[model samples]
Target: MTNITAGDVIFLIFCFSLAAYGYGVIHYGKKHSEEEKK
Candidate 1:
């Protein structure tokens, strides 16, 4: 049970980091395009 809980925590962290990275890439792409338009 404890091992499963540890694995869950690690999986959650990995998911959150992946989400954050995706958001950063999307946000930067939008900003770059706006700057180019200006």
Candidate 2:
């Protein structure tokens, strides 16, 4: 089995962070639009 390196871990963390940030932005935008319609 291959061992995991620090670089691999860092890359994974970066990808996850980007995904989370994108999701948060989309979620907030949806909420704001719905609120404006009310």
Candidate 3:
């Protein structure tokens, strides 16, 4: 097996951050639209 380097850890963090940010944006957007529709 290979060793996990700092770069790999950093890359994983970056990917997770991006995914969370995207999901937060979409979720907030939907909630805002639903509120507006009321």
Candidate 4:
């Protein structure tokens, strides 16, 4: 089996961070738009 390297761990963290940020943007965007409509 291949060993995991530090670079791979770092890349995984970066990917997860990007996904979380995108999700946050979408979630907040929807909330803001709904509030504006009220």
Distance from true location, Cα of 36 in model 2, Å: 12
Question: Candidate 3 lDDT, tens digit per residue, 1-38?
Answer: 89999999999999999999999989988878756643
Question: How accurate locally is residue 26 in candidate 4, as Cα lDDT from 0 to 100?
Answer: 90
- Residue-level lDDT of model 4, residues 2-37, one tens digit each, is 999999999999999999999998998887876665
Prediction 3 TM-score vs. true? 0.74
Residue 23 local lDDT, model 1 = 100
Q: After superposition, how far is residue 27 of candidate 2 from its true place, in Å?
A: 0.7
Ranking by lDDT: 4, 3, 2, 1
Q: TM-scores for all candidates?
A: 0.63, 0.72, 0.74, 0.73
Error of 1 at 8 (Å): 0.4
Q: CA RMSD for every model?
A: 5.0, 4.7, 4.6, 4.5
After TM-score superposition, what is the CA distance of residue 14 in candidate 2 from its true location, in Å? 0.2
Model 1, runs deviating above 4 Å:
1-4, 33-38
Weakest 10 consecutive residues, lDDT, candidate 1?
Answer: 29-38
The total number of steric clashes, by the backbone 3 Å criterion, in model 3 comes to: 0
* Candidate 2 residue lDDT tens string, 1-38: 79999999999999999999999978987878766653
Each model's total of backbone clashes: 0, 0, 0, 0
Whole-model alpha-carbon lDDT for candidate 2: 0.89
